[model samples]
Target: MNAENDLIKLYSGRILSLAGDIPLTERLAEPQATVKKRSPLCGSTVTVDLVLEGGKIAAFGQDVKACALGQASAAILGAQVIGRTAEEITAARDQLKAMLTEDGPVPEAPFEGYEVLLPARGYKNRHASIMLALEATAEAMAQATG
Candidate 1:
């Protein structure tokens, strides 16, 4: 497909709509861990805060500063991140990375919503921005658990 086609698909209505409906848009009063990831390529960033209890996330919040693609990803993460384990978040992050760069299948449920971003597979430059939320999430999870 041409670049225009790629851009059109990448910015579909569903993604643009999802981008505006982000959840967990706050900072926890006292988080167990917090991580911020930046896409130097796009100057997009996502800061994730987590509070874990009983080996699962009990509370979550995020400060998302990114493009539509990144916001869409944060929306997905915000939807399912609570009550999930660090390992689960890490797996989803890995699956998303593979889906973008290695021709892997969509991530499993909860995070399955990431399918909206499949068209981004062809745009290498946008990959980092698209991944900001999950990267920050996974990193925050790791710090929270360890």
Candidate 2:
């Protein structure tokens, strides 16, 4: 198979669906903290706005401008970000990086949904876009708590 075929496999049906399923595409009215992450290579961007209560995320919003891979990552994060803490988001981000760069297993539980991205492992340029959402969320959580 050629590289184009490999890229096609990476954007499987499930991944495309997730990419289109981004849930929180609006900005928060009064977010406690907000962060925007960008991938210089792909020019993909994901902006996260959040409110934290009692050390956990209470409300969240996002504006995602990325390719299918990045959008899928944001979709997963949006689906599960509520009630999450900075620690959890950071852990997920680390796990994702390991998965893409180190032949690591899919991220543990809550993040196992990332298995859909397994095919993306061989494509290094796409990694930055795929990581934008989680990175921004973790940073926003820190700013909210800082």
Candidate 3:
């Protein structure tokens, strides 16, 4: 397919739906950890804040400024991060990276929403933007757990 067709396919209905209803748009109050990630390629940025409890996320929030791909990624992360442990988040991040960089399968449940981003794998320029949220979340989790 052509670039236009790729773009259209990449911005599928599921991606648009996720982008339209980004959860955790507000910053968390008194979070234990916070992190911000930016994609130099696309100027996409995502800031994440969270409070940890018993080695798992107790609360989470984010501010995302990016394209539909990035927004969808943040939406998926925001929707499922609340009760996940650092290991889980890290694994998801790794899986997402693999998917984007190596043609791996979508991450497991709760994170399966990342499937919507598979179409983005071919668009190298959009990779960093799509990864911003997960990278920021991983950093925030690390900061909290440290």
Candidate 4:
């Protein structure tokens, strides 16, 4: 399949799976720590909320007003991060950066879901939206730990 088509599928899949219009729409949450990131190029914004327990993520959620790519990225991040440790989330963020920037090998298992975003690598403008969730999540973890 073509890159655009693949992106469309990934975007639609996540947007369709998105639950509860209020949180994502109204941007409401009481996160342990919140990190907000914006794609200056496109004006897309993604704010992530992380609740940590025992050095692991007890919950992961986000409020995003952006393109389909950003929404899907957030969904994938939320799904993989819950129950994972801060270290694990950091590793995933690095892996995601590598995948998008260096053509690195895709991470295994849960992160494999992010493979759909690989095509986003070629679209430089879309990179910010694609990485927004991960960056914010990593920052939130850092704030929680420190």
User: Which is the leading candidate under TM-score?
Assistant: 2
lDDT of 3 by residue, 30-146 (tens): 999999999998799999999999998988889999999999999999899989988899899999999999999999888998998999999899989888998998898888878
Report the lDDT of model 4 for residue 8: 76
**TM accuracy, model 1:** 0.96
lDDT accuracy of residue 17 in candidate 4: 56
- lDDT of every predicted structure (CA atoms): 0.92, 0.93, 0.92, 0.74
RMSD, each candidate, Å?
Answer: 1.1, 0.8, 1.0, 3.6
Instruction: Give the runs in model 4 whose Cα sits over 4 Å from its true position.
Output: 1-29
Kindly report which residue stretches of model 3 are placed more than 4 angstroms away from their true locations once superposed.
Answer: none
Sequence-dependent TM-score of model 4: 0.80
Q: Please state the error at residue 138 of candidate 3 in Å.
A: 0.8
Top model by lDDT, which number?
A: 2
Q: In candidate 3, which residue pairs clash?
A: none
What's the distance in Å from true for residue 10, model 1?
1.0
TM-score of each: 0.96, 0.97, 0.96, 0.80
Please give, for residues 10-101, the per-residue lDDT of candidate 2 as tens digits: 99999999998899888999999999899999899999999999999999999999999999999988888898888889999999999999
